[model samples]
Target: MSERNYRAAIIGTGAIAHAHARALQDAAGRVSLVAVADVDAGRAGEFAAGYGRARAYGSAEELLRAEELDFVHLCTPPRLHAPLAVTCLEAGVTALVEKPPTLSLAEFDTLIEAERRTGAYVATVLQHRFGPGAVRLRRLQEAGELGRTLLATCATQWYRDEAYYAVPWRGTWESEGGGPTMGHGIHQFDLLLSVLGPWSEITAVAGRQARSVETEDVSMALVTFENGALAAVVNSVVSPRQTSELRFDCERGTVEVEHLYGYTDDDWTVTPAPGHEDVQALWVKDRSEESSGHASWLAAVLDALDQGQAPPVTTADARRTMEFIAALYASAFTGERVRSGQITADSPFAQRMDGTGARWRNA
Candidate 1:
């Protein structure tokens, strides 16, 4: 694999599909969006036509059966992630999939095994970690400028109307996973886990407070991290306005980051200890590339593939995040503390979500 163009396929022509297409086009020389797939042929055709050099397929199965792709990016609903990813891997293709890899831990484990057997590069789209602000915050924490981060939490308040959940398979426990927690909260939660390391336990409660969906619209969780740091997470689809932020209260200083998704000029506020002014100087060095989410992860994947190495965000990482969600759901339903690593293949929550009796708002 010299400097030859890296051919790619995109499975799912939904809203997020365009983001993948644009990023692939941006990596023109190194990567090319060679094909597009969707259950809706019209959608796939339209997507392919809009983005140059793409052939369209009616379904993911059709694409996998016909195309010889170097890599495939899956923008399907969360429920389809596991099967589609495993299909791609079995066909000897790597998958760059959207977050909350599957509906349950059992599915995640099966996919992990598929990756092991097939040696596929399965990576999730947790691109927020690529932002300069996040990188800088990580560096500062490493340097002890923000010493002993004891408590952390994230807030994501975004609105999604009935029309939003009207799409088939949008708000079911079987389809989109579990609404805000798996679909919306996943991005920021991944960022949180990235910065704070692994969590030790979680207790949560979720309910369908607003829109009509099969899953919960509002949820809250209390987490204990491996480092003994406490965290609270609140996510909802009921807010009129959107706000996404992460705050880390540390020993020496408190660092706050505010954004709906990515970096902004007023992205961060760092308060250092009495003599830690030098920490701010570290931001002066220029990074060669911009820190936008999707593009950065694509760049990393292409580079890693070129170097014959694994992707930065691997299936194992996806498992951890999935476990986090599982634990939260388990705690919420059982009224018991759930261990982070306990949501394995054998965990009861692995097969069915606890909200079996309850139906999503729209579903």
Candidate 2:
């Protein structure tokens, strides 16, 4: 690890920014939060004051011009993610963007191009992948200890009242992206992909359901991975019995985690097949205690920077998750199974999650 300390800043002082602030605090000696920016200058000032010595700026442009930073955490709304990340990349600063990294794959591709041009990286914050249990599971799966992943189920079912969508950006296709599938469940399903490897195709359905919003309040999909592992995915913001859960039934055993938002080692349970009880020892061997959240994820990001390598949740990795999302929307709206790499630059879905407007919106 590099001995030199790194300086970072945050753009947008929202509820999520507090999580980023805590992560920076967790990194105390390694990374410092030097600045913060927001359209609401007062909010920015208050956030900076609460955090530490970070100076406040009225806008991201002002911060980028005035501060020399190693990177910036973008906690802005979904629509601003791509542009802010691109601005950071152009400024030769890495961007650690919150999830649904971009509103669309096309926007994410632009960031990828900017990285190629500027040699600055943009990493998405899919923190679940860094959790101790998730990390251990991936390690085991890669070592072929879990055996072949046969079937999996991933779901993010949480309730959001009508007041939740009252926020200007909350339920819109143009701002927050595609309801729960993009904003909420992406974390769980992204972790699923990290463990299962590349996905091959998706058949899905979405409905406006009960929410009086422009986007679907519920969506479900059948996913096929390249390794022949199948997964059933469900994303919803309308369920009263709230939970985020993922279960993988492997050839050797079953591994599962159930939690809302974040998880720790305790949230995971591993069951070995009748004769494969020995693998249980391997599961607990050398397991990390770190929980899934911004802190652990940021630690990995700093480590990558220390070694002069691109950070975790790289654009390519993020793209897979993003592509799956796009494919879900395509499948849901078009009523057809969508394959991986099927939505090209020419595809409307590439330009926007809803493509040519959602069917419900048209109706």
Candidate 3:
């Protein structure tokens, strides 16, 4: 481990920033929470006072200009993620941004370019991928212990009532990105992509089933992985009984996890086929206690920084997840199957998740 103790700041004093503060606190000796920024000065001051010695700034620009930070946790809105990250990158500070890192694929690409221009990095917080259960599952899959992955299902069925959308940025395409697919389900499906690898194609449908929002509250997609595995994905904010679940059926056995939000190893189950009973031992061996959340992910990010390597959830890796979201939207809107890499920089989908405008926008 490097001898240097990193100094960090949080750029948005929202609910999510509390998670970042806790994670930074968990890394007490290794990383310090130095400052926090928010458009609302009073809110920022209150948050800063609660998080130890962190100073408060009225704006991200003020924080960046005054504080010398190793990295900034960008818990800002979707639209601010890219620009704020770019600002951090330009300042030679790494940025750890929350989910729906950017409002558009084009914005994400800008981050990639900014990273190249500056040696600093941008890491998206897709915390689900860092959970111990997910780590073990990925290890087994990579070792071919999971056998040929045959079929899978990933769902993020969570309830978000009308009151929840009262937060101005909660459901709009421009500010929040695409509804459940981008905001809520992106976490579950991102874990799905991390485990299953690159996707080959996507055909999807999205609808405004409930809530009067500028975006679809529900979406469903059929995804084909490069490994020839087919999966069904459902993202919805209208479910009465909320749950995030993923099941993978392979030649050897099936691995499943059912939980809401974050999960620990207990949330996972591994069943070996009749002749593959030995696989159960592999699943339980060297299990991790870390749950899927900001703390676990923050640990990994710090590890990367210490080694002078790019952090977990690197922009390239996140780009794949973002591209998948883009393609899902493209397919849902155009009524056509969208292939991986099909949403080129020229594609409108790259400019915004809604692309040429969501069908519901005109309706």
RMSD of 1: 2.5
lDDT of 3 by residue, 119-181 (tens): 999999999999999988888888988799999999999999999999998899879988999
- Candidate 2 local lDDT, 174-251, one digit each (tens): 898789999999999999999989999999999999999999999999999999999999999999999999999998
**For candidate 2, what is the lDDT?**
0.93
Residue 39, candidate 1: how far off, in angstroms?
Answer: 1.8
- TM-score versus the correct structure, for each prediction: 0.92, 0.98, 0.98
Show the colliding residue pairs in model 3: none
Q: Estimate candidate 1's alpha-carbon lDDT, on a 0 to 1 scale.
A: 0.82
- Model 1 quality (TM-score): 0.92
Report the error of model 3 at residue 335, Å: 0.5
Q: How well does candidate 2 match the true structure in TM-score terms?
A: 0.98
Score residue 354 of candidate 2 by CA lDDT: 95
Cα error of candidate 3 at position 248, Å: 0.7
